[model samples]
Target: MRPRFVLPAAFSVAAILLLVSCNRGDLPGKKQLESEQVQASPVAPVASSKVVEELPGAAVSPLTVEQRLEDFDYMWKIIEENYPFLEVNKRLNGEDWLANKEEYRNKIAAVKTDDEFFRRMRFVLSRLNNGHTNFLSKEEYPWYLNTYVQAGFGYEPWINVFQQPNVLARYNQKPLAEQQSPNESNNDINSGEAGSQTGKTSGNVKKVIIEPDQIAYLGMRSFEGSLMEMDSSEIRDFLIEVKDYKTLILDIRGNGGGNSSYWRNNMVPLLINKPITYNTYSLYRGGEYAEAFMQARWLTGGLLPIANIKDEQMPNIPPEATTMFKDYNKNVDIVTPYQSVGFKGEIYLLVDSSVYSSAEGFAAFAKGTGFAMVVGGRTGGDGLGTDPLVAALPNSGYVFRFSLQMGLNSDGSCNEEVKTVPDVEVDPDTSKPLLDQPAIKKVLELAASQ
Candidate 1:
């Protein structure tokens, strides 16, 4: 379970829109986020002893070449033993990562200093091409994991490193907490004030008029968790009004996911009455974090555990003979229509490369179930699975992280690789507003033709 979409309990995204404002270019590393320091502070619990602390101007012979090689082997071993995307990566990239053992070792052996080693490690992990699996700055891990806890992942933190609510406020970088919001203007629709085809809803929701009563628009910026205290009256009123429209445009671009449940609970039910079903399979290894997350009853039983699988979904299954896959039991979610009249129209989900994690989950559902006609660019995948697990290099105290589960679509394809393809593709015009992008314009034309 990758907690990229999960967070600690105290977080609140109780509005209509998905929230979180990370640009695709801004994420750590795009996964390797560093602040160009010789010695970054590695947190305790994961690494406290023998940690070659990169103190300010302090000379320290961090690790011998042999020790560094051992640490490299440790990193390699854990990923080989537990990480689930090896086969999928091989199938998608046509490059077998596990087979590159000697190649990676040679690269690791050449890096002399701690900084060089860290940079080399980044190059090695980046080969996976996964957003969630990367070497994390220990300074950023707590906030990233806390993001999962608040997003309602419902897991016990095994390492005890994530106790702060800093919300990725480390590295002396601008905090993402302050950056997590979509563009909103006064007279937004959710506010219920008079407006010229535009108004704001709470949280990540925005509404606009594309064709008045015939066409309406809604956008969710992120899927942050637990909107427990938001007043329902405004949202319900908007939903009641939106239900009369002929079509709804559901936008989830730049929605770097927080919690999958936010949409499962808050946005989905109101608009959907009949069941929206899809099959999602995942590969995982039994570890402390994965087991604890499962034991907490977070899975809710749609995923049936299967072992020693010889299937096309994961053709290059992990080298580990005992690796396992959790086959989804065909999840069927039926919700009572909001006010007995869900949106009496079609839904078109707008997407782009920025759509990821739980948002990609939403796009997957739309694509698989035909619940919504997806529009725009392919998504930035990694939508399936649980929150990520963190560990540190014993020698250098360099922390690394990744999801325990590798999610697969209804078909055998890996979610992280295939992503969600658009039904009606259109290049978005960044110069225009979300409501008036080229995709929106194309969708408008499509709706007109209908």
Candidate 2:
């Protein structure tokens, strides 16, 4: 168990010194103020980004099939030796991982062109159960991201975590068996029950015909990225007139991780300005312990104003030490001071096993701040701080993202193994789409009743 620490008493918006050495030519906002007072200091740049360099004695891809196999072997060797987690081997144990690796090799080896080889490589990486593991040549990552964005289920991008649908389809694999029907004529097939099963192959899209009086729902997938960038304004507009609905369902199901600022910038406006201490940080030993900083209680400044952090004067500390203090203070810094807003509406947040990383941080914060009711499944087993550190593999030139700093929730509990358990436990129906699930239906029903 990790020892707990409260955010030091010295931490607050008010405690932050607003040092301004202004000139008439200066502009408004935090950056300008800081620039006038102190020299701009950027964080030490990461030296190792992903690069594509030819390996020694490696065949330049227009090589024979045997050479392609050797290339894959070299990449796997790099992953085995350099992967940060010692237990990564356990996850890849048994014939399954090897079988997939061979399948990828075969596909690549049989490819007639470079495009086909790239496609095979993507298939290989996709099989690696997604812990920031990948097979992209850095140039391909952006395209992959764009491809994923294009494959959307709806206007809002999200994940589908239903297991029953997959299991049942596998159990009733009629399509796989239908190809052996050489004896049957088209008319004969149409007369049989198998024809009816064909229509069922495609999944159903459920529609929730919500009334203006009925409760409206919005599920936050995660809280890490820029809230303004996410279609939050569309959600915000929907929420603005949400008083018509008796209840609001905000599902955080499977949302396990993200930054706290995502909440302060995006969510606070929708609710009553409840002044709550969200979370605190405890630096690891050997880290700098600095003077306290604080900000005063302020009103909703929208996204722009809230993000506008004014500069502070340095306390004449050492150059290196001063820079370290600034970096540490940025994460622990409370840009918007605590204040109150009166929201008369009720809110419910649905949580599930996928809620992890920064999503878990947001959930813990929501619970701590009394912003919403947490309902549904338990979170993905991760509730700690993680500062992403990237490392390049010496042989393959592949980049690996590793967690550096551990995070502590407001209550100082880090559930790396057990995860954040939901307050309301409801099993999701995997056989049905999320819109048709019992939990979402229940939320709507409750809202209607109210």
Off by over 4 Å in 1: 1-61, 148-154, 157-204, 226-237, 285-341, 433-436
What C-alpha lDDT do the candidate models reach, one value each? 0.58, 0.38
Alpha-carbon shift of residue 337 in model 1 (angstroms)? 4.0
Count of steric clashes across candidates, in order: 34, 32
Task: Give model 2's TM-score versus the native structure.
Answer: 0.45
The sequence of per-residue lDDT tens digits that candidate 2 reaches over residues 1-450 is 001111233224321111100011111233532232221110111123544422111222344566556656755554443332222222332224544565567666787644344344434543332233433343332222222222222211111111123211322222323433322422221222332334321111112225555666665654523222333344444566664566767766644343334444445544654344444332221221111111111111211221122232323222222221122222343323222233466777777766655565556555656677677776653344432223332222333232222233444333333345666668744357766887777666656566
The positional error of residue 301 in candidate 1, measured at the CA in angstroms, is: 7.9
Tell me the tens digit of each residue's lDDT in model 1 across 1-450: 111221222123211122221223233332233333322211322213465543211133456788779988988887876777776677656658789889889877887776677777766776665666666563445444444443443444433323222212222233334543311311121232222124433454666776667888876675544222232334555667778888888888777775565565555667776655455556666544455544553553545555434444555334432344443333333333333346768888889888887788788878887878999988888776655665666666566666667666776566777888899889944568756688888888877777
TM-score, per-candidate, Cα-based: 0.69, 0.45
- Segments in model 2 whose C-alpha atoms lie over 4 Å from true places: 1-211, 220-227, 254-262, 281-342, 381-386, 429-435, 442-450
Candidate 1's displacement at residue 342, Å, is: 3.0
